[model samples]
Target chain A: MRFDLEIKCKKIVGGRTKGKLLLSKKPINFLGMVNTQSGEITNTSNGFERQNLKGKILVFPNSIGSSVGAYTIYSLKSNNVAPNGIICTNNVDITTASGCAISNIPLAFIDNQRYNDLVNCIKILGKNKEIEITLDTEEGKIIID
Target chain B: MHLTRDEEKGLSGEYGEATSAAYRILVAIGEATDAEKLVPIKWAHVSGVNYNTIGDSGLEFLREISKDGKVRVNTSLNPMGFDRENLPELSPEFIEKQFEIARAYEKIGVIPTFSCIPYEILPIPQEGTQVSFAESSAAVLANSHLNIITNKESALSALASALTGKSPYSDLRIDENRSPMVEIVNETDLENELDYGLLGYFTGKTIQKSCTGICNISENTDMWSLKSLAAGIGTSGSCGMFQPKKPSKFIEKVNYGKREMNETRDELNTSEDGQLITFGSPQLGIEEISKIQTLMDGKKFTKPCKIFCPKSVFCKAKQYGIIDSLQKSGVDFISDACTCLTPLINKKNYDSIITNSVKASYYMKTSNKVSVALKSLKSIIKGYTV
Candidate 1:
């Protein structure tokens, strides 16, 4: 079944972006968890280990460690290996927000109340088919097939 | 977010690239947090100086802004990866990279304090003074102990404030957000710094994201104990300033038991046969230096033990003759950085480490990739007596 789900983005940066959805239930620490040079996820415990976030839509709950994680995200952009778009399901801290703003990466976030539902939906949405995100519009939505 | 015409111009790139970049960052962060307007900040203490952690991308960003723009307000930098002068055994390549990072910050008009405890040299902001601080312990300390207003800003946010002399009006800076959301009942009497630290760790783990009110503290509580709590909570969980009052009108109330504190203490303790004993996680002050010197007097140690403190206090130690005698006892000093934040972690691999800080124990597991045996300073210092 194909579905069109609308994500009520509380905050948006860089208008619109689209890419295949890559989701992680665990929070990320950009400093060590991400390889800025290649845009690959490094932290093994998160299950996305060695997976490249480049040209993908990176989704997660919130930031787990250091404020320096923001620069890691910025480095991803500067090196031309950044995620096409980002969606954090909790408070968009200055670290993640600044990373998106400085790098011109599109970012959208869901509030805590609806964050869990979105996580479950993404897990199910990524089961068999591909998913894409388009954040250019004021409304943040994902097209699922 | 509302912006004045001047701020609008800064956003429009009329104020040059540096100001425009910094302005755009602040406005974005402010908008994310639902901030209404911008406010001037008196101080900015930024972290993420460890080049080994942030790598080349961070260097690129720092140099890009610092080459043309200077900091607008007083600023302090956090620790770097290596001690370029004292730690001569480090690779020259690593030393050059560390120097590059330092120069980038210096060019931006940041004081090369390189200490996590920025309050050591920078004057503590008076109560209710708006400030932009990034280091977790420093943020909590400025808010709870020193009565200064701050939100836990990111490295970039703090850097932006350093360049622009302002931050978006946000959570902790607002007066209404200062009220406690949780009242923590603490009947247990904390005897030592470790106890205070464990309690703080417990508070952070228990009340994950609330402004907690802690009560039943002794009147004799000093800044050292407060620092232990602040550092513990900062590292363990994302907690903001804690009010020192008893149970009050708050949404949630949590009771801290001695059993839970003991469990945490046990969890933190590793092998007693530690390869190295490290002190000064947050960088020791003059009083701590004097205390350690007093304990190490006329004694010899066997383990490769070192105490970390900033250069400011290192000078104080030398002036007090604390370093000379301690050096004779086989103790080395790491000046200009804290042990946890420095790149020494990756270089110095160990089977086990002994430290007096719960915060140190937490960070060591991540930063150094090793476990730590949590000990009281008195116990660790006394164990070295020959």
Candidate 2:
């Protein structure tokens, strides 16, 4: 991959991986709104409702709802249907941080500005083609090719 | 964040995987929150006991950690799925999974005090004692009523605290953050626990600060009312703690009048009638049960009634024959399981529930996918008691 953009981010949980970007403008609720068995977004209005998040780097604003959402994330990992990594744009709550920690998933955060930049990059690259990005937790950046 | 030699060792895996994991979680959270160091805590009350809430994921996590995990501090547990003494007709798998969670916690050296109201049953440490409480209502009450210190911790963080006996010295643990940044003026009289719950819901939804100042509620507000207020705040939003007095300095001000209270009520109260009437989202204390015993006054319930209380409280009530009397009045006492997020009550079993607890109302609607008809304790007595 010929990497170009490198956006600074904060690492909540460690491990580097590359995967297609799956973006959501709204905060996610893992407990009820995400199906653990299939890694599908269950909320009717969440845009990517029926889409499977398996192996994708999920980009979202943040997590909401019960703290048990942490367990739902862990459940996803245990069930072998989970995101490759998670990138939160706004905030990294205890629920998100702990969930990712327990599940050994690379979780990172970016500022709203960087989030906008990533969104623009995705827009320009077009959504039809899968956008593979490298998430380096140790480097604390999201590298786009 | 600074870590002592022992803390560093724990983080470096000298102590074991569980301790290392706990330290990592605390340090990560501490660094994120900009805490200077980890603080020692006297107690840790952990949540995530209910199988319905955590599902398979939580059970697996618990099993994995329980292998090497042991509590470093006095740790307590939250409510589980059902009462062991009076088991409801739950699925075999749910019962088995719920027991596995209990066994895991027991193996990890949790006190098995399967009640949300730790402040109610457990002996109070000093007023300024630092604790890690995952139960949101208990955390709020610890800060507001008991003058103890704790952030409204998530289930995993509190579990990490249990294993490590330390928490991040950030958020409400810091003295500066304890002061309310928002002022919530109560414009209407809070006549009952439900009203206080509504006021709390209003304050929590409106204020985004770590703590808020609640004016006009008397310092003499009773314990039940305070618990309701705590549960309501814990349910609706992330505002963890509150003060009964006006804030010395505040950036925002909001009012909790009849309109605001009605708005909250309308949001939570989705059903005009309910099939089952329930009490105790924060498991009913002995005092609350006693009050209910008196209120029953030998009258039977018009509808099926279930009262979720702590086993300790249930035993005491049973000793007094209050349980016997209430049982005669067709009130079923369920210990070790609460009304909120319990598999015992769900959309499959019941279409709607009647509850006086704002916390219960919120979770029943959202988590259980059932409608809620929120009523005051007094109003329930008036309408349901025959």
True contacts kept of each: 0.55, 0.29
lDDT of 1: 0.77
Name the candidate that leads on DockQ: 1
lDDT of 1 by residue, A23-135 (tens): 77766767646777888776575566578888998878666446677787888898889998888775676778887888888787777756666566767775655567665
Query: What ranges in model 2 sit over 4 Å off?
Result: A1-5, A18-29, A40-65, A112-134, B247-250
User: All models, DockQ values?
Assistant: 0.53, 0.40
Off by over 4 Å in 1: A20-26, A32-56, A78-82, A123-138, A142-145, B187-189, B208-210, B262-272
Alpha carbon lDDT at A90, candidate 1: 58
**TM-scores of the candidates in the order shown:** 0.91, 0.91
Estimate, for each residue in A53-83, the C-alpha lDDT of model 2 and write its tens digit: 8899999866654556777788888889899
How well does chain B match by TM-score in each candidate? Answer: 0.94, 0.98
